[model samples]
Target: MRGWGGTGCPGFANLDKAEPLKRGVQCPLANETRVFRISDPETGATCRYAAVPSSHTFSSAQQVCTSCFGGQLASIHNYHTNAEMQFWGGIEIKDTEFWIGGVIDYQNQAVNCHWADGSSWNYAHWQQGYPQHSGHACATFCVTDGLWRSASCAQQMPFVCEF
Candidate 1:
């Protein structure tokens, strides 16, 4: 058999052969059944999602995701690899930048973001002219553009919540 790296075949292995398993269907793995919910209050479309954890800076996104659908801010996963071109999160900034999840680590100091799932802020997608470090605080998602941008969390913008 060939290993994951596709290196040389194992000893006495049938590299070119294909093995077929029994035809009986099998149940999905427990972990694979995990689901996250998302909702759009404007359109009233409730959706179950399986997406990687993302970060955003909009209370409206969280409110819409939770109140309208039934999900909370997205959570971080250690094994996540597929890069999300864009998604929502829970980091907000306005007059005074502060994390919606309850902490203000990103400022003149450095990019310090965190999530409720205990994941570190290693990835982010900021909108044009974002992370503006000049007395700007709070974070949220912009519904018009559907991208994560820095804003006043207290300014009252729509947010996305994860399940």
Candidate 2:
């Protein structure tokens, strides 16, 4: 099942009727720290987006973020942050999906989705009926609906970096 983000678009209105799909894993990096100066002209904030290769899994992508970009996977907090990510990711990746900082808690057998940065996963924009309990232990931000979706951690996809 897919998740929903906006309501004006097709298939976006029926998200409430959709079923929760498999959830992903969100393990924080140890001693991971870095900084960048990718300034957003609109918000006047410094943030950056790094696109991992399509052959990198969500776990490996996190390493890329910590080692190469000096940051972690993008941690979206609100609609504006999500929109900004969607905008820049669309321009950078064009037609590819990317990983974000969301993971599920399999130990508890629940959808305890949390960000890699240790932020609370209070805000969400699932495609429609997603976060299934399938065996997919990773999360990816889909370009089609601009919403978060579940995937196998081993599945390779480009990823975004946040500073």
Candidate 3:
């Protein structure tokens, strides 16, 4: 016997409409230790380090690193250790210049830098007799033609926030 309805398929009119589900916005990785890689625009060098804290003045960067990243800025144990060949250290920021993590030793007029592996500044990466101590005591990373220079930390500039 033939069916009463002209169409053999069942009607979907009785089915309920599929509503779109709303999702909450959230960071992919929250409150977790993660490594971030940053590249220098001028030098074309890439640096990878565990999460970075918010970018702030030299003094503020220290505080944030201590409170957030467990200690001062991170350092590169051996650039060659990582196949990537680059790392970020706890250098300070002043104006548009980057200063080694060290402050005036008082006894000696040398720039001291902090290392993440609990090592002191044995190697130096100054830019032709830098850290001129012009009354400004802050550090910043330079991405321009110059890699790291001394500048007033209070000055605002674009910084790379890791964590």
Candidate 4:
């Protein structure tokens, strides 16, 4: 039940994941890097994620996370995780649009999307009528509505790392 960023998780009142932090308080940060860790007691599954200190395009961000954190871009497998990411880390808010662990290479084949971490692309919260791809495209999540949109893999933006 340790808080992230080694700062005793300022303003965090509990370890319960169901309870979001108080309004106006943000996730723990170490020198302006947003980071947090969550574990499911029932399954003993834990995930630690952070907004990468540097922003880059999708592929570059992937390389950065792999080299620095030994992790991949944070992947959203379900609604709960996505919501937790939004609430606990604000990874997307780190930028107007931030890179997540998703890339779309298959044309209009949402089922074929893959995460950099090699996680199954079981869930997606795409923006309306999105995935209009002609070739390879990457995914970007926006905080406005927590919806994902397709973007060029070469677009520079903030990203998250998870392991």
Query: Which candidate tops lDDT?
Result: 4
Ranked by lDDT, top first: 4, 2, 3, 1
lDDT per residue, candidate 2, 7-89, as tens digits? 12222122233422223322223222112224445455555455543447888777755544445778776777777677667
Reference-based TM-score of each model: 0.37, 0.67, 0.44, 0.72
Error of 2 at 64 (Å): 0.6
Deviation (Å) of 56 in candidate 2 = 0.6
How far off is residue 152 in model 1, in Å?
Answer: 1.7
Per-residue lDDT over 1-163 for candidate 4, one digit per residue giving the tens place of the 0 to 100 score: 2212333323223322223343422232345455677665545666777675456888777765554454678888777777776665464355667888898887454435888787778899998988667678888877667789998898798887775
RMSD, each candidate, Å?
A: 17.1, 14.9, 19.5, 9.9
Evaluated against the true structure, the overall lDDT of model 3 is: 0.37
Runs in model 2 deviating more than 4 A are 1-45, 107-109
Error of 1 at 132 (Å): 2.2
TM-score of predicted structure 2: 0.67
**Displacement of the residue 2 alpha carbon in candidate 1, Å:** 34
For residues 1-163, could you state the per-residue lDDT of candidate 3 as single tens digits? 1111122212111112321112311111233324455554544555434433334555655454444333344443332422221233233222333322444221255554444335555543445656556544443444233334556666444333222
For model 1, the local distance difference test gives 0.35
Pairs with steric clashes in candidate 4: none
Q: Please count the clashing residue pairs in each candidate, in the order shown.
A: 32, 20, 18, 0
